[model samples]
Target: MRFSILASGSRANCVLVNSGGTYLLVDCGLSQNQIVDHLAELEVKAHDIAGVLISHEHSDHWGCVESFAKIYGLKVYLTFGSAKARDIQIDNVSIIEITPQNKIKIDDIEIFPITVPHDAKQPVQFILSDTKVSLGFLTDTGRITPFILEMYDSLDGLLLEFNYDDQMLQHGKYPNKLKKRISDGYGHLSNRESIEFLRRVNVRELKVLVVGHISDNNNTLSKVTELLCEIGGEFQKIIVQKGKKTGWLCL
Candidate 1:
């Protein structure tokens, strides 16, 4: 299996995953034109994508889902709450309502959606596998749950959220309310929280760790790098920047 983070951040977020030629997009936050350009950079066509799996209804995550799915005639897999929250209205696009109960199969890949603790209604993160290799795509979540720890126990690759630095957020220019919202359990994860998660999970079989959803204003790459250095793991680390794509990594 191979995947690329087309874009990741507060502004927009998307990911492209390919398992034996069956392509799937985790989210469609970018404009259609931008997604096309990024796909071209990886030599992938938009039409080749089989489906789009939406995490939640947040604009940064669900903004372009309808348009993109309509344009490509692709299926959109999301929770009922997300669909209700967005009030999706595209007639031609296939809307598959998913829950954390069962796994969905799309050609070569099997996707398992697990509920996450975000402010949005019925938000979820994904665990994808092609039988041989498995990947966990998690972001936009505030805190990791026991269910998450159970599902993500053995991953070949992980695209995780390293959204902020705790100290920086506490002292940043943002207002008190926004700061409280961000630091609260329903907001994004901090560098310290992410590190703690890494420590708790089993990384013995983890090969690639792609850190994403970094806050441009509240965190710096150097800080993320320094934190990563302290972990001292054998997994290959790729720190993603806002609006930038991490070239495809295979596992």
Candidate 2:
């Protein structure tokens, strides 16, 4: 399987996963033109994309899904609540509804949408497998649950959230309520929280770990790098390091 974090940040989030000749986009947050350009950079054609799986209804995750689907004639897989919350409507494109209770398959990939605690309606993260390898795509979540830990126990590749640094968040310019919301269990995960999660889950099979969705204001690359280094012993198998966006990992 080939995994690429096409774009990941506060502004937008999108991931590309290719397995057994099928190309799937985990989100369509980027504009249609931006997505098209990125696909070109990856040497993948728009028509080759089999489907798009949305994590939530947030603009940073599901913004351009309708336009992308309509333009490329690709299917979109998202929850019913997300469709309703976003009021998503596209004329001829197919929008497949998937929930935590009901999984779906596309070619060799079997997608499992696990519900997560986020502010959006019916928000979910994905665990995708192609029999031999599994890739966990998780972001835009507040806290980790037991179900989440169990589901991502053994993943070959992971795109996990490291949204912020608690110290910076507490002292940052954001209002008290906004600060509480982000640090609260219903908002995004801090770098410390993410490290704790990595400690709990099994990383025996982990090949590449991407710390994503970093806050431009509340977090810094140097801080994230330092934290990961401190917890490097936890995931002895994972080569923890600071990474830039737009790179491919083969598993």
Candidate 3:
């Protein structure tokens, strides 16, 4: 399987996973033009995309999904609550409502959607497999759970959320209420929280660790690197890379 983070940040978030000629997009936050450009870079045609899976109703995750799927003639899979909350009904697009923990198959790829704690209606992340290798993707989550650890424990690759730095968020010019919301359990995960989650998970078979959904205003690459290094031996074991700017990764 080949995985690529077309973009991951507060501005927009999208991921592409390809397996056995089946291409799936986890989100369509980017504009149609931007998504097309990124797909071009990957040598994938927009019409060739098998499906678009949404994580939540947030604009940075599914804002352009309706238009993108309509234009490309692609199916979109998202929770029913997300679709209703976001008013995601559009002509010429196939909207398939999926439930959390339900497994769906698109061609040769198997998709497992797991529930997540986010300030959205029925948010979820994906675990994909082509029978040969498995890849787990989690982002925009606030707090980590034991169920998350169990689901992502032994994946070949992981795209996990590392949204903010605690210090920066606390000291930055943002309002106190906003800061609290971000640090709250239903907000975003801090760098420390991400590292703690990683340490608690079984990383024996985890090869690639790609940090995603980074907050440009409240986090820095240096801080994320420093926090990861603090994990001691576990930090040096996996091939870690930050998403968005790192382009594509294959395993």
Candidate 4:
């Protein structure tokens, strides 16, 4: 199986996971043209995608949901509330009302829609697997919910979030309200928090841990790399994903 993070940040979030030529997209936050262009850069075509499974109704996540589905005739799986909020009822869409702990399957993938604590209504991160490997995606979450921690205890690969650095976000030039929102446990995770979570997980068997959704105004690639290095050679053995780039890894 193969996985890639097409883009990640406050601007947008999208991930591509393919196994045995069966492709799935985690989100459609970028524009249709942008998504297509990025895929082309990766030598992938639009029609190659089997479906799009959304994490929430946030525009940063579903910005191009309707357009991508309409243009490609691809199937979309989203929560009922998110569908209502976005007013997205596409003919090719598979609107699944997912529960906190429900496990469902689509085509050749097994999906576990693990609930996450975010401001959105019933937001979830995906754990996709076939017969050999399991790829877990977690981002845009408030904090490290125990459910997520337990579920991702032993993943083959993870697309995790390390949104901001405490010093940078606090000392940077931003409004007080925006600062509060970011620092809130309900917003994004700092680099420290992300590292802490990585330490708890079983990183021995994990092939890769791609850090996603970083704040450009508040964080840097060097800082993220250094933190992972501090965790010792286990995570350093894998490649890291960037905020606005494509990172592909095989498991």
Candidate 5:
């Protein structure tokens, strides 16, 4: 299986995951043209994508889904609440309603949508599994759930978030309300919180760990990486994804 993060974070979030004969995307935040460019950069085609799985209705996650689906005939799988909130209307795109805490199998992959504390109407993080390997894609949440711990034990790769540094958020130039919102339970996860989760899960086979969705203003790559390594042990490789770029990982 191969996976590449086309981009991640508040600007535009998307990930292309390919396993066996199935090609799936976690989000479609980028426009059709931008997405095409990134896929082309990785030598992948737009029509090769079979499905798009959305985490929520937030603009950074669901912005270009309708246009992309209309262009490529890809089915979008998301929660019922999120679909309603987005009000996305496009033909040839089926909506597969999935709730957190339930496992849904699509073709060759087993998807477990784990519930998370996020500000979206019904945000979910995904843990994807094939027969041999498991890849957990989780972000845009302030807290992890018990279901996550179970998946951590089996994951060969993880696309997790280290959204911010607490001190930066507290002292940065952003407004007070925005800072408070970021630190809330429903907001993005901090570097400290992410490390705590890594320690709690204690994943050993975690080969690829991408520290994703970092705040460009509030956190630096070096700071988040240093803290994560301090708690993520010394085995797993960590990569940070930024802008309209690609980070490759094999599982």
Candidate 6:
């Protein structure tokens, strides 16, 4: 299995995962044109994507979901709450309402949706596995939960959120209310929180660690890098930048 971070950060977020040549998109936050350009860069055809998994109804995550799905004739898998929140009822696109209990199979990959705590209604992250390897996609979550630790313990690759730096967020110029919203239990995970979660996870079998959803205003790459240095290991580490496409990493 292989995956790429097409875009990440507050502005937008998207991920492309491929298992045995079967392509799937975790989210479609970018515009249709941007998505096409990025896929072309990776030599992937947009129409070849099998499905799209929406984490939530937030604009940064679900901005172009409907248009992209309709253009490519792809199936959209999302939670009932997310669907209702967006009022998605497109006739041309197939909307597959999935719960945390559903283990959906699409060609060579099996998808497991796990509920997460976020500001959005019924938000979820995904764990995708083929016969041999598994990849976990987690972001837009407030705090790491016991269920997340249990379910994501054995992933070969993980695309996790490293959204903010506590110090920077505390001292930044943003309004207090917005700051509270971000730092609150249902907002986003800070660098320290991400590090703590990493320490608790089983990293012995982890190969690729892709950390993303960085805050452009409240966080710096150097800060994230310095913190990550403390958790040095043999696993390959990647820091995804905002509005950038990373090269494919295989598991």
TM-scores, each model vs. reference: 0.96, 0.93, 0.92, 0.91, 0.92, 0.97
> Candidate 1: worst 10 consecutive residues by lDDT?
84-93
In angstroms, the error of model 2 at 36 is 0.9
Where in model 6 is the C-alpha error above 4 Å?
90-93
Candidate 6 structure quality by residue, lDDT tens digits, 159-243: 9899999989999999999899998978999999999999999998899999999999999999999988999978999998787
Model 5, 37-87: lDDT tens per residue? 888887788888878999999988987888788778778989877887877
Tens digits of lDDT, candidate 1, 1-251 = 99999889999999999999799999888998999999999999999999999999998888688888887888999988998898875343499888775898999999999888888988999999997999998888888888888888879999999999999999999999999888898998899999999999999999999999999989999999999999988999999988778888999
- True-vs-predicted CA distance for residue 105, candidate 4, Å: 1.3
lDDT of 2 at 181: 83
| Prediction RMSDs, each to the true structure | 1.4, 2.7, 2.6, 2.2, 2.0, 1.4
Give the alpha carbon lDDT tens digit for every residue of 1-251 in model 2. 98877788777888899998999999887889888888888899999998899888888888688877878788999888888898865433498888774678998799999988888878889999997999997788899999899999989888888899999999999999999888788889998889899889988888778778889889988887887787654332222222234656788
Q: What is the C-alpha lDDT of each candidate?
A: 0.90, 0.83, 0.82, 0.80, 0.82, 0.90
Candidate 4's C-alpha lDDT? 0.80
Please give, for residues 127-234, the per-residue lDDT of candidate 3 as tens digits. 999988899888878899888888888788888878888888999999999888888888888888888888887777776778778887888777777776776643
Clashes per candidate (backbone, < 3 Å): 0, 0, 0, 0, 0, 0
lDDT minimum window of 10 residues, candidate 2: 234-243
Task: Check candidate 5 and list the clashing pairs.
Answer: none
Task: Kindly indicate the candidate among 1 and 2 with the higher lDDT.
Answer: 1
Instruction: Give the clash count for model 4.
Output: 0
Candidate closer to the true structure by lDDT (higher is better), 4 or 6? 6
Residue 39 lDDT (model 2): 85
TM-score of 3: 0.92
Error of 6 at 34 (Å): 1.0
What is candidate 4's lDDT per residue for 83-127, written digit by digit as tens? Answer: 777775644335555555778777788888887777787688899
Task: Assess the local accuracy of residue 146 in candidate 2 as a C-alpha lDDT between 0 and 100.
Answer: 90
Poorly placed runs, candidate 3 (over 4 Å): 89-93, 232-244
